[model samples]
Target chain A: MGEFELIERFFKRPARRSPLGVGDDCALLQPAPGMQLAVSTDMLVEGRHFLSTVDPLRLGHKALAVNLSDLAACGASPLAFSLALALPAANEAWLERFSRGLLALADSHGCELVGGDTTQGPLNICITVFGEVPAGGALLRSGARAGDDIYVSGSVGDARLALEVFRGRLSVPAAVFEAARARLEQPTPRLALGMALRGIASAAIDISDGLAGDLGHVLSQSGVGARVDSVSAFGLLASPGIPVDTALDLVLSGGDDYELLFTAPPSASKAVQAAAAASATPITRIGTIHAEPGLQLVDRSGAVLMRRFTSFDHFA
Target chain B: MGEFELIERFFKRPARRSPLGVGDDCALLQPAPGMQLAVSTDMLVEGRHFLSTVDPLRLGHKALAVNLSDLAACGASPLAFSLALALPAANEAWLERFSRGLLALADSHGCELVGGDTTQGPLNICITVFGEVPAGGALLRSGARAGDDIYVSGSVGDARLALEVFRGRLSVPAAVFEAARARLEQPTPRLALGMALRGIASAAIDISDGLAGDLGHVLSQSGVGARVDSVSAFGLLASPGIPVDTALDLVLSGGDDYELLFTAPPSASKAVQAAAAASATPITRIGTIHAEPGLQLVDRSGAVLMRRFTSFDHFA
Candidate 1:
């Protein structure tokens, strides 16, 4: 069978309640009353985003997780999603494993697979997720105000280190190798943390393109600036076996962390602390928002550690 | 610069209103109050969906049109979309033309380019469109019931004929060539008819994979069957210079006609007729829903037409 036939036989199925589903021009979805929609799209390519040798399940998981992370950045609850998959040919085994991985994450997140398209080409998977937030209550990158405190959930650089091991450039301990690989393959989306921060955090974003780069988006959009403590940012590097200097680089420029970086007004500091304390997620205050329009890194002595800004650039 | 960097340079731009625009994990959109959402996705691959020599502008238009047609089928007003583009290399002129075509259609349909991903590979373009509909008012494929009259807006088979001509296997008059080629290159999405059908038609779908195949979806979904009058269906092909017999074949299984195929209850016939008259969209009653389950095409003499149930199957 050709690619088109494969999609017809396998991917096309009836939607339980969607007014206009698979065969229509578009799928119709009705959101719960009083909720605004949160939307995100992510694309994964064979060589650029993942290796061809990677497990189909992990690839599917990562694909949905990365997009879900975007929803988390906006403090939106996952709802539904559509996938557009392009592949060289129909492989029944690969489809089974890939769909299993995708459905596993979808079930956990309460997101339904509402619509999608499948085609023939080099392996490329694009997922667009739809979510909901209370009307006028979504966490926005444009909401960060000067004098707000900046926080990051969990540690960064693990994904980058995993990439190093995957590239065979780093000889890591077996335990560390497995842990880092897991982090890269199936990073958890900070959905609860995002929901918790909705009212308290003035602005929020996920660190997909490294903390420095993603934070820059918030700074620029909010018309504010930041002063990140380099020493505090690199604290995770001190964890047992990681090289401090290399870890520092990964922490700054590594992409695909999927950790939420947010800002809260001074009055919300207590609430932020309490929310972080209540959750299983780790939150760290790494810096503060500034009135000036630029990113700065400071050392322990408050000396300027870096004057130039750096982060992952997908196109660069 | 790398592929990712190229995307940022050309495709990424600042949006004044989107709370979460490009460079963030996701986008937060506030649809106008009291409206539900319509979502659709489509993927196009080189050598599969279109020839390599096809104009980039037409490619962009067709890609976006396919998704918009989905929204149209749902009777949803267009809102915004995300694009995932895969290319072999950076071609400035081609990109310019492609974007122009995409933007032109988006502007015409009142949809915005909100977020997207760009990567390097064999040429493929996937677009996901979001639209808005009044709550509980979107059209669906499963709503068709026995005794509902089946209708299709506009003539079919021109697109398939154009492809035949493109492959140099068919030759026709200049007028036929021009009309068919236009239909192939820029198939019009029946947005007006769809909007009119909202709450009036029992079930609806856009005819992308020919009337027989797409209508089969509506029949299967609604748990009903249909006996389309082959002679009446063929009458739609009587326009200009096309022969009746040739048109019948095109109408039956020649896909790529982005027309609305719907089934309306007898009680709504007057309303459907009035709306079609007011909107000037030709609405042809080709068949009627049946209690049994299967699709059949009967000639004037009541003989079953010998035809295969095949259209564009992504997997095939």
Candidate 2:
């Protein structure tokens, strides 16, 4: 079948939620009145962002999930998104599985598939998501302040552990590897937690490029430093079989964790915890924002640990 | 320099118009109250949509321009857009020219550069543009009705004429080739024309995949047919030096003109003309919508010509 036929059969859906959908040159959306639209775009390439053998179904899920994570960072409610896909060839089986996976997640979040383009080329998936937030309510990196308590929702380092196994640089038990791989392949966006923390959290960011590096963004933007508890950070790892020493490195520097890392005033600690429980996600207070301008890791004795903020840089 | 530094030096701009811009996880936009958001995405692969020999500056402009064309078809005013770029390397010179071209057109249309992702891969550019139109005012392809006068804005076929020369299948005079080449590389998005046609147009579409094939979309969706003027379509060709026969073929099926094609009632002809005059874009009556469900082309003798509606299909 032709490109148009493929899209009609697989990607096209009724514009029930949106004002218009796939058939038009442009899709129409009516954002809630008085709310500001939040927009973000993310692109994932084969081999660079995923394994060549990944399930197309899972790939679709991850593609939308990653962009949703950005919305969560901004405390925005999903409205709609567009997909720009480049494929080597139109494989029906792959398209079927991929669309099913993508549509299911999209429906769950009420994020309508608004519009997109499909072209012939190397496999690449780019999604631009639209969302909404109340004016002045978006949690920004520049809002973090000294004396704010930094926290992370959900476990970190599991995805990194999975990457190590995929790279053949480390070995783990089969069950452990499978669990870690799931973390890497299918991350749940902390949408609920993010929305809940909007009025409570001072600043927020989703962890795609490791906790240390992402938090560094908050620090740089807010003109503050961080004093992280290395032991507490490593203790938050989900891998019970792996020793803390090894997990510590992954927890500190490895990437691909979609956890929400945020800061709240010391007074709002209870609210932060309540937001976590409300979202059914765990919250860990691993660091504190400080006036100094460098990220410092400290052990229980309060001695600083040597650290370098090394996150995944696509060009690097 | 790191990713953030590169972005700052090259892409960072003062958020003059958008509610919030580049540094955030998601850019925020406040659409005018009661307006619907118009969104579209298009991706350009290095070897697919454009040639390696084309100027990087023009390539950047075309990438965003194609998406803007979609908004124009919808009769939406330009708002904001995000860019998802995948590059083989972070070449400073190429990026400098690219950003310059992209930002210049965006500025011209008052479209803001919002948030997006950048990574390393085969060179690819994906842009998601957002716009706004009054509720129920968008000119859609499905609104064409029987007896509506079909019209095309500006010239056609020049881009296709340029493509033939690039393919080395034909050659023209140096000046003629340059003019055609410019059309191929930098065809204007008829944004003002589209916005002006808002209440006057019964249905509208952008000529990305040639006049005949793209108009088929209006016919198919509207459940009507069209009787096109073959002579007038050829006359609309901008290639003054090209032969009529060659121009006829190019105007009919060559892609990437980025012109607005629409239908209006005979009663609204005066308004359509007025809109064209206000927008400073020429409008040509090329066809009429019919009750039947097939696109029909007729010569000066008024005998129907067989039309297959062949357009650019990515997987074809």
Candidate 3:
């Protein structure tokens, strides 16, 4: 099939919120008045972002999910997204599964597929997502202040543990492996929690490159330090029976966690809990922002841990 | 350099018209009230889209140029764009030159770099551009009616001719090759003309996958056919000394031409000319829309041409 046929068969949908959608050179979106359009893009290459053994359906879901995670970080409501894909070949079955998974998530979020380009090349999936937020209400990494309470929504480190099993470096029980693999393959973007914390959280970021590394962005941007409870973070790992050191390593440095790490002032503690309850997403207070200029991991007895953890870097 | 450092060193720019650019999970844009956001995305893969031997600068320009051409087709003013790029390695020299070319064109059009993702993989560049048009003012491919005067901005086929030279399929004079190569490497988007033809043109599309194929979209979408003058199209090929058959093939079916192909009413001919003149972009009236449902190519004597031409299709 031709490029147009591929798009028409699998990707095209009638325009809903958009004035024009697929089949147009450009899609037209009218954001509500006084709303700021939030834009983010993520590109996933086969080996770099996903394993070759990954299912096409899961790949599709993960591609859009990662971009949505960015929108979630900004506390933006998903509106629309564009997918630019390059495939090695025009495989009908793979396309069917991929599109089914992609559009399923899109429909659930009310995010319409607007426009994109398809070509013949190495498999690459790039999604640019659009969302809307009230003017000046976007959660940013630079908003954290000293004395702010640091919290993380959902769990982390499970995705990294799943990666280890996939790499054959570790083995786990079948049920545990399946659960961790699911977390790695299909991450849940904390959209509700992000939106709920918009006015409450002083700073927010979705954890992708482990909690410590991603939180480093918040600390550096906000020009503040943080004191993370190492034991508290140890509990963030969902997998059981792992060594303390390895668990801490995965919890602190694992990549592909789509949880949100955010900060709110102590005065907003009650309000933060209320927001979490409203969103039905669990939240855990694991740290506190400090006026100092470095990240400190403290043990249960309040002794600083000397270990260092680095985040994933594409060009490291 | 690490991913964040690479982005900070090269791609990050201060927010200009946008509320945020490049530093956060999402960039925030607030369009003027009553304006529709025009969105388009294009992915350029090495070997498929361009030669590996081509200069990185030209590659960068062509990437953004192609996407801007889409916005132009919709009569939208450039606003902002996000670039998702995957590179095989962190080559500082290449990145410097590429960003220079990309940002130069972006600055020329007043489009800010908002947000995107960078990863380690085989080279792929995906750009998602945003533009703005007044509500109900954006031109579309579904509005062309029978008796509309078909038009083309600038020229076509030269880019394809350049590719032929590169492939050693044809040889031309030094000047001719350079000129054709320029067309291939750095085709200008007819943004001004598209904006000017906002009300004059009934339907429009950017000539990317050759005129015949791209126009087929307008025809199919509008449920109309067209009678294109083969001789008139032959002149669109800027290269001289090429045979009529070869020239016609390139002119009618060549890809990578970022010119505008559009339709306007016979009554609005004068207004179309005025629009073309106001934008200072040359245009040719090459055909007329018909009530019939098949494309017809005619010679100067108005006799139908029996030859068939297929536009570029990635899979085919």
Candidate 4:
């Protein structure tokens, strides 16, 4: 059979009651009146994003979590999403487990699985999430101004640390190792923290490619720079129990933290403090925004220690 | 470097303005005001979707076109899309031309190339398109009623025929072969016809997986069936000089037509006719919706012919 015939035989299925479901030039989704739509997409490859040995369920959760985190970055509430999954072959059990994990997350987030496509290939998964925010109210990276305090929620470097362990470069206590591995296997998307920071934080971004790289994004977008105090940044490493230098490296360059790094003006500090107290996520002040347009790391004595460059160029 | 590091090094570029962009759990985009979101996604594998010998530029166009066709199926106006591209290795020239073809289509359609991820793997492209429709207004498959007439825009089976020629199973005049080959290589997206069918048609779907399979979608969604006049369906084949039986097979089962198939109430027939005339697309009445819940094919004498299932089924 030809490609068209193959598509017909394997890809087309009857859609549910979507107002504009598959078969049109585009699928139309009606957002509730007065709501703004939130959109995000993520791609996961077999050996790249997840080990072939990874559980399909966890893989699925990570996929959805990653996208939902983007929605959380904008403080948008989940609405629906479409999935594009490619697999070497159809495995009913794998699909069932994967779908369960995905649906579990979707159910918790109140997002519907509105549409999807499945095809045969080396395993890859791409999900596009749609959410809703109030009009003109999405938190962005461009809003930070000079004198705003920079903050990162929860911890950083656990995933990267876990990767080091996975690659046999680092060894840790059993409990710490398991914890780090779990962190890598199943990340908690900080949607609540993101939503809470919406109005208070001047700018916000999630730490996926590492703190230094992600912070650069916030700074560059805000047209401002930052001087991150290493002492303050290292404070987040207190519980991780690695050497100060090693911990600093992890925090700086280790990726997949999935935590929110944000900036808030002095006027909003008190509100942020209270919000952090009420939220389960830990928040720490790590730096301050500057008028300059580059990121710098400073020692506690205020000496410039390092100037970091961007991390994780996927194509390069 | 490994895959994860590669993603961090290359794929995670900085985007400060987007609520969620690279280096985050997900990227977030704000839908335009007063517009409902439209979404569709498609995955194209190297060997599955295109031959290695095919031009990268054309491959790129075909990839985008398939997803755009999905958007057209829903009658939504295109806006933006995120792409997840996997390649065995980086090819600068291939990337440039492929991106040019993709961006050219995006520009023409007013869709922005908002976000994407690239990685090392076998060639695979997954694109998720975001579009918009007027709030509270979208064409749906479930809206078709039993008495509605079924109509299709443009000719069908040309792509399938072209594929047959490409496979060396058929021979035709050079001009005819090239015309068919063009249809296979670059199927036109019926965007205008879809937009024009909005409101006028009770239900609409694109014919990507052949007439029978796509019609089955409307029938299932609308809780009705259909009776297609085989004679009328073969009208397009008359000028193509192909055998009637072969043409019928192509019409009934061949896919990738990318034509809009819609059902409208009898009262709106005149309006559909007028819209079809005004549209740059050709519209043909090929069938009628039936109160029954299964499809029926009829010959010129109104006698039922052999019924068969037609369309793509991923798992099957």
Candidate that would win on DockQ: 3
Question: Candidate 4 lDDT, tens digit per residue, B1-316?
Answer: 5544444443344443344455433455555667677788888887666778777777777888888777676677776678888888777678767877776776777766666677777788989887677766667777889888998888888878777778887676788777776776677777777677777888888887788888887898789989887434343354455777777778878887877888999999898988787767888888889898988888879898884546765545
- TM-scores of all predicted structures: 0.92, 0.97, 0.98, 0.89
Looking at candidate 1 chain A, the ten consecutive residues that score lowest on lDDT are: A230-239
**Quality class of the docking in candidate 1, CAPRI style:** medium
Tell me the RMSD of model 2 versus the true structure. 1.6
Off by over 4 Å in 4: A1-28, A231-241, A307-310, B1-35, B231-241, B307-309
Between 1 and 4, whose TM-score is larger? 1
For A1-316, candidate 4 gives per-residue lDDT tens digits of 4333433443344444344443444456666666666777778887777798988788888998888888877777777778788777777678767877877887787776666677777888888887777766778878889999999888888888878878988777787778877788788888888877767888888777888988877876678999888433343344555676777778788877778888899899998988787667788888899998878788889898764445665555
- Residue-level lDDT of model 1, residues A1-316, one tens digit each, is 7754555555565665444455555677765778777888888888887888889999889999999998888888888889889878789899878988888998898787788888777888999998888878888888999899999988887787889888887767787777877788888899889988878999999988777888888998899999987434343344576666567777878777899999998899899988787767888888889999998888767888753446754445
Q: List where candidate 2 sits over 4 angstroms from the true fold.
A: A230-243, B230-243, B307-309
Query: What DockQ score does model 3 reach against the true complex?
Result: 0.90
Off by over 4 Å in 3: A230-240, B233-239
On the 0 to 100 scale, the lDDT of residue A305 in model 1 is 73
Please give the interface root mean square deviation for model 2, in Å.
0.9
Residues B1-316 of candidate 2: C-alpha lDDT, one tens digit per residue: 5677668877888777788999878899887887988999999998889998889899888998999999999999999888889988889999999999999999999998877888889989999998999988999999999999999988888788888989987678888788888888987999999999999999999999988889999999999998986435343354455666666778889889999999999999999999999999988888899998887788878987764557889999
Per-prediction interface RMSD in Å: 2.5, 0.9, 0.7, 4.6
